[model samples]
Target chain A: NAGVIQTPRHKVTGKGQEATLWCEPISGHSAVFWYRQTIVQGLEFLTYFRNQAPIDDSGMPKERFSAQMPNQSHSTLKIQSTQPQDSAVYLCASTISAEQFFGPGTRLTVL
Target chain B: AQSVTQPDARVTVSEGASLQLRCKYSYSGTPYLFWYVQYQRQGLQLLLKYYSGDPVVQGVNGFEAEFSKSDSSFHLRKASVHWSDSAVYFCAASRTGGYKVVFGSGTRLLVSP
Candidate 1:
């Protein structure tokens, strides 16, 4: 099933620069979720999309962060004017039921 | 709001020794608990989950967890440890019928030969 796929295993961005992460969910999976993982916070939910429509994004930062799932196949997470605090591993997951299949994740380093 | 707590940040054990990782959760209604493991440079993988019935659930890689509603705890255990079992484990909790999941800080296990 190849599970979920995420591009750019690692990323480096300077402070104030913009960064974009991409994820391709498993085929026929209708739910896509984005999460941030760090040593301190562990894993935190950022947003989710069900059947190509956003369902909840309350966990997303109020500023400089946005996510969109234009179709059932792929989703994108964009961070504008990135800061040092934004440096963390971004994980993407897709689920058909309650069990989620996770991607390897994109590690973002904001210097 | 639902939350999970993994009290131990790090645990060390010798190969062939018994292992246990503790988890506690807080929720108002029925809870769905899960254990996920992350190896170095890898994504998190589901170890096991508890939905209903049997408080004890078995998972992949010979791992098992017990759910105790009376104490609001779900602890992961393995009869014996192997060097390959060294990894970071996370405990997550979600309310029944809810999509959002709350994860614990995680416990890093170090298994020595």
Candidate 2:
């Protein structure tokens, strides 16, 4: 199986620009998760979906961050007016049981 | 709220030496604990997990963890270190019926040959 797949292994955007990262989860998995990893913050939960419906998003920043799982196979995380502070590796994962399989992640850099 | 703490930010050991990484968690009820490893430029991979049953759970690559409810701790250990075992290890915990997983800051292990 391909596990989870993320698009645009790397992304670079300006301070005010917007960026969208995509993820394709394993087939038949019911849960999808998004996490942000940084040297300072470590790994932080951003949001998650079950059966294509959002279960929780408390970790998401209220201002310029949003996530959508339009279908069972895919999900997207969008950041508006990106800033250097937002630079990090955005990871996507899917779970069938308690164990999760992660994608390669998209390394986003804002300059 | 649930949280996990990995006290050591970095650990180094010589090849063929024993190793141990500490993890503690806070939660109201029974907690599901997990150990995950991440090599450079790679995604997180599950090493092992503890739900109940025996306090000591064995995982891949000869790694095992012992969970202590009284101390709220789940520490990972290996008898002998290998160069391939060098990676950033994270401890995570979640309550039953909760989808959210709280992760620790992670402990980076460097094994020298």
Candidate 3:
């Protein structure tokens, strides 16, 4: 399997701009997850979907952060009015069982 | 609430030395634990996982972890280390059959030759 794929390995956005990150899960995987990593905050769970449905998003910032999985293969995480605090590595993972396979992640740099 | 904790932010070891990275979890139910390794600028790679079987689970590159329900701990161990083993390690936990996962602050391992 080619494993999970994430688009735009790196992204630069000015403050107040919008940014979208994409993830393509492994074939036939039923669960997709999103996480954010920053040196100050460590790792934070943004949200997750099961069978293309959002299951949990308690970790998301709510105001400007949102995620969607419209189909089985792909999921998108969008940040509107992005801030400098949003600068971090956004990770996407896919799984059918306990273990998840992760994508290389998109490094979002907001200036 | 569920959470994971890795007390060590960074660890350094000489090549060929043994290594152990600590992890602790706070969960009410039986949780599935996992250890993942991340090379610089790379994705997280599963080093090992513990579901319901034996307490000790083996993973890639001579990596292994032991789970202790009483201690609420799942610590990773390696018999001997190499420079290639230098990476950030994360400990994660999830409720059984649950979708949400909790990750610990990664432990950065620096293996010196």
Tens-digit lDDT track for model 1 on A34-99? 999988877889999999999999899999999999888899999999999999999999987677
lDDT of 3 by residue, A11-108 (tens): 99999999999999999999999999988987788899999989989899979999999899799999999999999999999999878999999999
lDDT of each: 0.93, 0.93, 0.94
Residue A67, candidate 2: Cα error in Å is 0.6
lDDT, residue A21, candidate 1: 98
Question: Sorted by TM-score, highest first, which candidate order results?
Answer: 2, 3, 1
Clashing pairs in 2: none
CA lDDT, candidate 1, residue A55: 97
Off by over 4 Å in 1: none
Q: In angstroms, give how far residue A110 of model 2 lies from its true place.
A: 1.0
**In model 2, which regions exceed 4 Å deviation?**
none
Off by over 4 Å in 3: none
Q: What is the Cα-based lDDT of residue B67 in candidate 3?
A: 97
Ranking by DockQ: 3, 1, 2
Looking at candidate 1 chain B, the ten consecutive residues that score lowest on lDDT are B93-102
Q: Which of candidates 1 and 3 is the stronger one according to lDDT?
A: 3
- Candidates sorted on lDDT, descending: 3, 2, 1
Worst 10 residues of 2 chain A by lDDT: A95-104
What TM-score would chain B receive for each of the candidates shown? 0.98, 0.97, 0.98
